[model samples]
Target: MIRPATPNDAPAAIQLLFLAMEDIARKISGTNDMQVVTHIFEHLFREPGNQYSFENTLLYDAGNGVAGMIVGYDGGKLHQLRKPVLDYIRWQTGAGVCPEDETQAGEFYLDSIAVAPGNQGKGIGGQLIDAAVARAAGEGMRKAGLLVSTDNPAAQRLYERMGFKVEYTMPFAGGRYHHLIKKIDNA
Candidate 1:
């Protein structure tokens, strides 16, 4: 079942974020950087007013004992000038891996959408994305956007199939990693 996440869901959301990040990092860097990344992601994405605001969603797979989550941000005009520069510094410092870009196609931002490894390939991800878009549209957003790691083509293809188009790609300091964005119209 898909549901809107409340503040009470923070703990579970943090836990899930940790699990998802560890899984991805193991696949990508294979280092012990997951904890650091997860902590930063949780703080920046969930802790509103620090720099931005987000509307997060959670999916419960009662029958399969799994849960999925989607985190979306408002991306107000303030972010255009502030966030990209901040992200650039963070990326340079090896504190994070996000592209510094300004998106005008959407008022809402889907930061990260993750499904438990054990329950992947069951369409839970699509459901979560759909729900998030609906919520954003309901809130008067004309479009939605998200970023995916460029190395993860499987996820990029999935987003493309869902009508997301790549907007930009920025290489990490190592030049081996990149972040890609896809913009979707709610209308």
Candidate 2:
């Protein structure tokens, strides 16, 4: 059952996100940096007016845990290609980097879609995507997009099966990343 996330669900949401990120890191770089991952997750809940939103849906396990998550937002103005280059070198020269050809206007970003490890292979991911699509349509968004790490083939396959196409691929942070876009009718 998908429902809106409230402020109380912040801890569970962060846990689900961490699980998903661990899976991604293991699949991509073959490393599990829990410290950095935890910091990022903590920062999201700590920061005020963060870019990402988690009120769309939060998958309950029906027992005592969260099985997955589907997070998206009206990311029409968040995609800037030169954000990394300028924000990094100018401010923090040795800071972390992201995809170089960032987002452009009119793109609603599907920031993250993750399912728990134990609950995977059971069509939960598909359901999350469907929920996100429905929400995007309801919000009258123009196009939905996301950045998938090129090393994560499982996620890439899942996104492709859900009508997301690879608009372009580029190198970033010593690795490859794919910018996937899905055009949806905002009518």
Candidate 3:
């Protein structure tokens, strides 16, 4: 079952968060240390209105436990939602950065998605993505967008099968990525 995540879910969701962010988590956190990154994001996870807040996340519970998670929100609200994250990073590490915008107005952006290590290969991820796209359409967005690294053909193929087409290429999170978009027909 996929449901809206809450602050209470942060502890269990921390690893999933790291899974989604991967190395970009290090870049944004300004530390190569997973412990520091986990601490900082756990703090943000408990907060509201930040990009990493539970307010924008959905958790896939596989009866026994959380199997996956997805974080998405209006692309137009990127700057507003991201401010707190950047501020926290600066405060924690004394590094200030404004990475290239990964999303923009007129779409709902899937900022991150991850399947738990133990639950992967069971199709939970595709289900989570479908749920997120439906959520976006329900919220009146005309498009849903996400980024896949150009180097990951397997992931690119997966997104393509899910109907997300490459709109263009862009540099994001210190890597070249293909920005993909899927039309929200019902919206």
Candidate 4:
């Protein structure tokens, strides 16, 4: 079943977030220590309005644990949503980042998504994307967008299969990325 994530999902969700984040997690944490990154993000995850908060997350719970997650929000709110995270990073790591805009007006951005390694090949990812799409449509979004690393062809193929088309290529998080979008409304 898919449901909005909550504080209780932090531990599991952070692991999944870190898995999806990969190198970005290290950048955000300002360190390569897995424990420190997890600790920092888990703290942010439990908060309510930040970009990494539970307010922006949904997960698949298969009666036992969180198998996957989709974290996203309105592109127009990117700055508002990211402020808390930036503040938290400064407070916790004493460092800062000037992340390039990976999203913009007129879409609901899918910030991150990952399925637990144990749950791979189970079709859970598609279901999660479907859920996010439905939510975006219900919220009156014109489109849904996400950034995929250009080097990750397999992931790009999955997004293509799900109706996303490359709108452009740009630099983000220290690599080239394809910014893909799929219309979610008639407009």
The best candidate by TM-score is: 4
Clashes of each: 0, 2, 0, 0
Poorest lDDT segment (10 consecutive residues) of candidate 1: 172-181
Q: Would you give me the overall lDDT of model 3?
A: 0.90
Off by over 4 Å in 1: 19-55, 61-66, 77-105, 172-186
- lDDT tens readout by residue for model 3, 1-187: 9999989999778789788776887887778887888888889999999888999999999888888999999999999999999999899987646678999999999999899888988888899899999999999999999998999889889889999999999998789999999999999
Which residue runs of candidate 2 sit more than 4 Å off their true CA positions? Answer: 22-40, 46-48, 56-63, 79-101
Local accuracy of candidate 2 as per-residue lDDT tens digits, 72-156: 7666545432243234323522343343434656666666677777888988878877777777777787678887898899889
Q: List candidate 4 stretches off by more than 4 Å.
A: none
Point out where model 3 deviates above 4 Å. Answer: none
- Candidate 3 lDDT at 77 equals 99
Which 10-residue span in candidate 3 carries the lowest summed lDDT? 92-101
Give lDDT per model, in order.
0.58, 0.62, 0.90, 0.90
Error of 4 at 137 (Å): 1.0
TM-scores of the models, in the order given = 0.64, 0.71, 0.96, 0.97
